[model samples]
Target: MLKKSLISVLCLSLLVPAVSLAETATHAVKPLTAHQERMKTCNADAKGKKGEERKAFMKSCLKGESAAAVKKAPEAKKHEKKTAKKPKTYKKLNSQQMRMKTCNVEAKGKKGAERKAFMKSCLSNK
Candidate 1:
């Protein structure tokens, strides 16, 4: 029974894909929605157009806004080049400098003599 069931499952998996390919080959997938149809038409019309020119043509063609206006706007700033943020540069600190920085942070919000005393104690500790 195990062998038979395994054979049947394998057969089904192979058969299903063959049937799918045959169906696809026989029938073209037509655009069902208005937007999809417009996209299809625009893509066909935008043939031979490259880069931003193709993009502008496709946008105008899809909206039916200005099908004949396949012009590129030089100053439109449509494509902004995103620059990767530079990592924050930190000054390398010696042990004493690091200790002082930590002490200063620990002594935050204290006033006048109290702050001065806390800094003195914090700086004195190993």
Candidate 2:
């Protein structure tokens, strides 16, 4: 009984996808026509211009007239002057400098095991 039930379930799963695919194959998709493409171009052009310039440009474009009638003004200023000072750069420690620093820190009265533990803790903290 369990074998028959499992076979039926497997058959149903296979049939469902086949039926959906067959239905989709018979349907047709419509593409966007020339008029829609022209309107998309006009909308893109009007989006960058502001207020009166935008309105005048859209009106002239829509009426099939040239863009000469639209008076284009200078773009509005959007950026602010940064008054903050630039951060200072320091020279990086070379391999020799790093070794000297490690030796100096270890020499400040720490024994071998304590020095190892301190170095491990410093690296892990970083």
User: Best-fitting candidate, measured by lDDT?
Assistant: 1
Candidate 1 residue-wise lDDT, 5-114, digit = tens: 99999999999999999899877765369998888888888788888777777777776866435454322435433344567999999999999999999888999999
**Which 10-residue window of candidate 1 scores lowest in summed lDDT?**
73-82
All models: lDDT?
A: 0.79, 0.67
Model 2: residue 99 alpha-carbon error in angstroms: 99
* Candidate 2 TM-score, true structure as reference: 0.32
Residue-level lDDT of model 2, residues 98-119, one tens digit each, is 8667766765787799877776
Error (Å) of candidate 2 at residue 39 is 1.3
TM per candidate:
0.37, 0.32
Q: List the candidate 2 regions with Cα displacement exceeding 4 Å.
A: 1-29, 72-126
Error of 2 at 125 (Å): 99
